[model samples]
Target: MDAEVGGTSAEEDYKPESWYKVKKGGKAVPMQREERQPEVSGAATQERPNHFKRAAGKKLAEKSVGKQHVRIPDGATRIILRPQGGLAPLTRLGAARLLYYVCKETGIFYGDARRDILSPNEALQTLLIATEDKKRAEKYQQIASITTEEGSKTEIKAHMTIPESRGKGVIHNVHLSVSDAEL
Candidate 1:
């Protein structure tokens, strides 16, 4: 192996010179130098990192609540919803009502009931899904009203009030065991 010395270039040494002869098996062998293309002039030799650009600048400042635009400052504020009872005791009708109201006011639709009482972070997962369905999301705002009206017409409260009546308590029972699909 050979290397460039001092100011000599890589090409100057890659080609065989008169002083040194290439040989194989104690016999002189013809060496074929591969042709190489010249680098482009003024071409950017330094690799640049890939950068992402958003053309819709400053438009991100405009906040959207469902389909409506809401103006707020660039600070964080927490809105608390205190359950009528402790979280554990929160029934499906109660949780759906609270969730409906929260979605109405905050423009965040978390869908319906959860088998487990979710923390704030887990609740945010529903928001990601909400982003896709803007119109249907508004339905969540009125879910409590629809549910209440339907329940009143069907005497749902009286039926659900019965203790340990599993199948009979449709709304309340489903609320306790509902999945992401219902949401």
Candidate 2:
């Protein structure tokens, strides 16, 4: 009988090799041809940006000279009142009454501003300002003493505190190593 494939006699296709005629790699195991690894002709890794050096410019070194961001100062100024004999803690109503007296004297510091006068922590010792006229607010700088409703004289101190350089969005790149050398 003619061994034909796809309606064609096998004799026309003279490829005489058969599966059984092929060479065996032993134990019917599939085998792969030995392949030589490609030659190492150049660097296998890339040189990335280092801390001291970058692709564009030098990093922000402490010695680097340049303009810095402008920071806004605190909005409200604080007033501290130290009585001749440290102020006795006052109740809320009594404190408000005391601030009323203070505002009566320094009407510029406390005005129509809702929070023009506030007793933040030291109800009897601190007077807060929320006035808008900052230029005129300097009048508070001249204030030295306050006479309370009881007519007791007290030394007055005022100051404004600012936040430290928060280092917002600051980044510092540390050296990394793949081997013994820093990269």
Candidate 3:
């Protein structure tokens, strides 16, 4: 038992160590040197505080009074709507109606709505839709009146610019005729 224990101890002690021999006549040197990365300091080393930690002690001001009412500006008559991209005429008209109602209820101007309006994009689109609807309705009404008269023939001639998406160029001359029989 003593011999077996001595042999095991000797085996454990004989574990390999990496060493390099010096070229000029001398001793074995350790092949590996102990190395540590340089510690980073100052602003570069500091981590940014998380949002919750930064705002931990801050308290929002409480409202002392009820919310202030928005007032419409003086001398403002109509809201302007500018539609970008290719939107349908009906869509522009619908947007206009929605905006008209919103302005009426909120008592806010077009510029003010950017901040106060729940959805600014929807409001703008509503205004455009309303404008298109009005223009188209007026033109159709004029045509209807001419076609309604009894026992008479009428010709309506008009010129209008067609939208770019429809095709090239403005419609130069448009002519329509209606007789009592057709009506």
Top candidate, metric TM-score:
2
Q: Model 3, residue 139: what's the lDDT?
A: 35
Question: lDDT tens string, model 2, 103-154?
Answer: 6656654444335544444434445443335653565545566666666666
Q: TM-score for every candidate vs. truth?
A: 0.17, 0.36, 0.15
Candidate 3 on 82-137: residue-level lDDT in tens? 32332233243353444444443334354444332222233333221112333332
Clashing pairs in 3: 92-128, 92-129, 93-129, 93-130, 95-125, 95-126, 95-127, 96-126, 96-127
Please, what are the lDDT tens digits per residue for candidate 1 over residues 40-95?
A: 55444322212112323334534322335233223212222223223332334454
How well does candidate 1 score on lDDT at residue 119? 28
Candidate order by TM-score, highest to lowest? 2, 1, 3
Tell me how many clashing residue pairs each candidate has.
0, 0, 9
> What 10-residue stretch in candidate 1 is worst by lDDT?
153-162
Native-referenced Cα lDDT, model 3: 0.35
